[model samples]
Target: MTLETKSLSKMDFVYWTSLVSGGVAGLVVDIVLFPIDTIKTRLQSERGFIRSGGFRGIYKGLAPAAAGSAPTAALFFCTYDGLKSYLGQFCSKTQQPYVHMISAASAEIVACLIRVPVEIAKQRRQVISLRYSTSLEIWLHALKTEGIRRGLYRGFGTTVMREVPFSFIQFPLWEYFKQNWTAVTGTALTPFTVAICGAIAGGIAAGLTTPLDVAKTRIMLADENVSKLGVSRILHGIYRDQGIKGVFAGFVPRVLWITLGGAIFFGFYDLTARLLSSDQAK
Candidate 1:
């Protein structure tokens, strides 16, 4: 096949492959790491961690997370791969980083449509005071009281803010890491290598964006009156009251959770994609 033909085929493959692999990866990582994520969310909540259930009910939000993780991840990879392929045609090799950033950011925006709702439900349930009997109940309650935009889609803007910059940083760095490793070794990239790169990139991104993340969690779990203060005001409030420390609440767990999550997610995704590709080649 010609290079163009090969590219098209790759994009075509991504449609199914990304869905399957991303779903599997997302489910595994999210479920396996639920407790850590709970801890992180509680830390970032406006309520103190001790007051937000502390170590109790770590899996309270598992239902929403389990339900949303697969679709959100699948959508992200499909959009990301498709965009990367289409946009790459218009950019020089040297400009590929920008293409990756754009692709990742776009994918994140699309994924956030699902992710924000999941987050709203999940984070709220993670806190004891905000606990709902079920994910569906959480949604119903939010919709009833706050409506869609303020309730179901609470924290959408802050989520996009946190996620887009995260993708911009993480995806480019991941691509760069993989590229350099392949160039230096003159070998095909492996799932393990991809995972290592993902871990590093995710850790850096998660650490740097902790404040935005804190803001997102707070917004999602906040009462209507408090949430109306908006991301900027909430951020300022946190900074004013607690200084830099409060802004970066949950920094440790956030970094650790994402680092491990990235490794598992990308590792499984690469492995599953390769398996599917090999099967197709037969």
Candidate 2:
């Protein structure tokens, strides 16, 4: 609840710590779990799971995902930590959850600038790997033919819609879990404990937001014309066509993937930040 908001200097140790640690966490978790993500995408694809190359070529989207994950996460934590510190100065301890929520929402907005394009290319490749030999090929095809908005950033709005609510749920709970653990143990939580908190929070958030995620995935994998129908229309169509089960496509895989990813990401982030902070103190 307390933050030392001395100033907004990017040269500060905490800034670099957040940037590097978040990057490392994001890159490692995303790459390790890329296959699970591929499965989730195929399951959510309009082409149907088996027809969309089910289990074949699971690493189809690794290139763009790897390239984008680090920076996007770096940007997220940088924005999140900085804003949390800056904004913490304006609120009471009881209001800290709102602080976390606002910071995370802002961070997600910033992160999505890069995440959306990578997601578009990544999901597309995951579902249609045979149609394109490389991730770059998909990116080029989208941009060249569809232009930026409808192509590379095809699901930008829905992604923000999904990610914002996800952050709203996950971050507040992650912080709350850490606070509770620290209070109960009379000591700060270790990276592993923090990770457990993250896994719990992330799984809950992912499960709750599966429908929004399904909409984002559907929009991305849908034809260019379908992209224009928007999130509401897409959701309606999915419900009308496939029923309630259709709206929650890939729910299990999504929750599973995110639970594992949250542990890796938050645990490594804490470890990396602690290491950097220790080195700075030394």
Candidate 2 error regions (>4 Å): 1-11, 185-188
Candidate 2, residues 38-154: lDDT per residue as tens digits?
Answer: 999998888899999889989988999999999999999999998998899899999999999999999999999999998987887888634777778888888899998888888
Instruction: State the TM-score for model 2.
Output: 0.94
Instruction: For candidate 2, list the clashing residue pairs, or say none.
Output: none
TM-score of each: 0.95, 0.94
Error of 1 at 256 (Å): 0.2
- For candidate 1, what is the total of clashing residue pairs? 0
Model 1, span 18-53: residue lDDT tens: 889999999999999999999998888777999999
The segments of candidate 1 whose C-alpha lies over 4 angstroms from its true place after superposition are 1-10, 185-188
